[model samples]
Target: MGTVYQINKGLNRPISFKGLKAQYIAYLSAGLVVLLLGFTVGYILGLPLVVLLPATGLLGGGLFVGVNFLSKRFGRYGLMKYLASRRVPVYLWFNSRKLFTQLKIGEGYGKK
Candidate 1:
């Protein structure tokens, strides 16, 4: 229903935000959006702005910093490789194959 599979989807994109490229911008944006949403919800619920804002700010800022750290440590492609390496290897490449069978009465390989 919604992009159930992706084949060869990885692309090394350029810096789109203040030298942040590829997944870095996405991580930063997601962290900021989360912070904004949390702040908005606290405001709508009439929570004490003094306490709520700082708490949410710390949470969001932590997320942003953590993501930024990972991005710098792994870069675009290395991070992908690191994540992918965690998964089980489901494929092994091999070469050469043949199917052989003796013909029977009124039967052939393709006929059946």
Candidate 2:
């Protein structure tokens, strides 16, 4: 007998795992990978296991906490929207009106 697994049928829903949603999962995974690489490099370079172990453990714990916090605070797409909002300028400082004036209905600049 073969085992059957239930598939997700939600339409356009963000992927989530263990309360971590969408990009937060990726963030946590990447952080863990970086910590693993750092630990490996430190070990190869002869750094004591005591130091590497504690440091890696602390970093991994921090990564999990931070990612979980972000996931909870900013729903699925809120984080991306927040980041995009930061890129918007507070005020537009146009030096001159020439740029706007040159724009005409159905015509290019300096063209008949």
CA lDDT scores, all candidates in order: 0.74, 0.90
- Candidate 1 pairs with clashing backbones: none
Q: Write the per-residue lDDT of candidate 2 for residues 7-104, one digit (tens) a residue.
A: 98698999989999998999988898999999999999999998999999998898899999999999899999999878878686466899888877
Error of model 1, residue 105, in angstroms = 36
Q: For candidate 1, lDDT tens digit of each residue in 11-82? A: 654555565657788888887887888888988999998989789978977887787777778877788888
- List runs of model 1 lying over 4 Å from the truth: 1-13, 89-112
What root-mean-square deviation over C-alphas does model 2 reach?
Answer: 5.8
Model 2, runs deviating above 4 Å: 92-112
Instruction: Report clash pairs, candidate 2.
Output: none
Displacement of the residue 106 alpha carbon in candidate 1, Å: 32
Candidate with maximal TM-score: 2
